[model samples]
Target chain A: DVKVTQSSRYLVKRTGEKVFLECVQDMDHENMFWYRQDPGLGLRLIYFSYDVKMKEKGDIPEGYSVSREKKERFSLILESASTNQTSMYLCASSGIRDGGYTFGSGTRLTVV
Target chain B: AQTVTQSQPEMSVQEAETVTLSCTYDTSENNYYLFWYKQPPSRQMILVIRQEAYKQQNATENRFSVNFQKAAKSFSLKISDSQLGDTAMYFCAFMKLISGYALNFGKGTSLLVTP
Candidate 1:
């Protein structure tokens, strides 16, 4: 079965700490995305990569950075975690031909 | 800018009943795609149904179907014979080539299935 796997299901980080959330897909999809989900905000895109070593900022990219070193792996980095950054983070991937995305089980992050 | 809107924040339907969740979007583009995604308690997001702007026939998957009105820019999801496992957060999203392959998601509607 195809899958998008997130490295962590839940994480607690201290304020000002640098955090990393990793995602890997086995479907050989060309596109990978990271989003943060809040109560009322729904899912806000943080970053997405169309190919290895290429990345683009989404609507909510502040305080966040992404790394795509390989075709199947994408990492979301919180440069300096803050309390306001606490939210559920999701990773998704889709093929160039597929119109919909397949998402991984999300990571719930709490920045204290 | 393209924006997707889910007017109902919360909804409840009895098991085995039918329910419809409304979604509307704002976009000037004539060609695009609309999708409904379900996120259960496990937080695993899954695509429920999708409709293409140019297609007149609504898309259906199992017990789920969509009401797509291209001229009105409305795409609603209908769940028939709803089951307990169907309870989840449903989000409506819009995608267009102009949006750079990124999906603009709505606020999501929290649905509960009761016996």
Candidate 2:
């Protein structure tokens, strides 16, 4: 089975704190993505990396950044956490195409 | 911009019966991919089905099938003999081939299978 492991399932942080959400995939996929899932807005892409050191901004990349220093691991970083950034964060990985994505269980972050 | 829309916010189906969830997308890419993802309460998004735009035949996986109407830009998932395990949030997504291969997902439909 393909596994995408998220480091945290739930997180709470005070405002202005820097946060990190980690995701590791054992599939050795070339693409890794970070998405913010809200109630009505669905899953909006934040950042995605097609290679170990390459990254691209998605639709809602305003308050978030990503790090992909290694191939199997991708991390989403919030420079300064805010209440509006509180939502369910999902990480996914795919091969080279868009056939389908294997997603992590998701990390629900609550910024106070 | 490409968009995927799942009109049904919530749906219910009795176990052993069938249920169909509707999804419509707006995209200009002639050759793209459409997918149905199931996100259970555990929050793990699983790929339920996938369809290629160029293929005339709809894709199916076991009891799950898709009705793909390319002209209408519609893709719907039909589950036969729906089971309690089928209850989850279903999302319709469209994949773009430009820049990076990323999925643009709909808000999602919350499915409930009653026994």
Candidate 3:
């Protein structure tokens, strides 16, 4: 079975503070993604990495950036955390084929 | 750009009953994939079922099955003999086969399976 693990399950940060959410996958998949889920809005992509050091902006990448220094790890960074950034963040990894995506448990971020 | 829509925001069913969740998507691409994902209160997203556009046969996994209509761009999930463990937020997602783009998701439907 594939396993995608997130660094934190819950986090709290003050306004203007920088936040980091980490994700690691054991499957060595080539594709990794970050998304924020909100009520009635579903899951919106924030950033994605297809390979090491290669990143692309998703639909809602503002105020957020991502890092993929290694194949197994992907990190999402918030330049300046705001209350509006508070939401459940999810990380997913998939293979080159149209295989199913494996997702982390998600981190519920609270920006006060 | 592709978009997914789940018109039903909430639904309920008694245990051991059957329930269907509707999903529709708009996409110009002919080759794509549709999926149903379940996120329980624990916040873990679990892939329930998937359908390939080229295939006419619906996909089934145990008690979970999909009603895929490629021409209509519709993918509905049906859960038979629903259990309390089936209660969760269900999301429908779409992905283009050629573009390698991210999965487009719907707003999701909150399901309650009462015992």
| Alpha-carbon TM-score of each model against the true structure | 0.97, 0.97, 0.97
Cα deviation in Å at residue B112, candidate 3? 0.5
**Candidate 1 residue-wise lDDT, A8-84, digit = tens:** 99999999999999999999999899999999889999999988999999999999999999999999999999999
CAPRI class assigned to model 3: medium
* Best model number under lDDT: 2
Ranking by DockQ: 2, 3, 1
* All DockQ scores: 0.62, 0.73, 0.69
Error of 1 at A22 (Å): 0.7
Model 2: per-residue Cα lDDT over A1-112, one tens digit each? 8899999999999999999999999999999999999997889999999999999999999988899999999999999999999999999999887467889999999999
RMSD of 1: 1.1
Q: What are the chain A TM-scores of the candidates, in order?
A: 0.98, 0.98, 0.97
**Interface RMSD for each of the candidates:** 1.7, 1.2, 1.5
**RMSD (Å) per prediction:** 1.1, 1.1, 1.1
Ten-residue region with minimum lDDT total, candidate 2 chain A: A93-102
The candidate, 1 or 3, that scores higher on DockQ is 3
lDDT of 3 at B25: 96
Measured with C-alpha atoms, the lDDT of residue B97 in candidate 3 is 69
The regions of model 2 sitting more than 4 angstroms off are: none
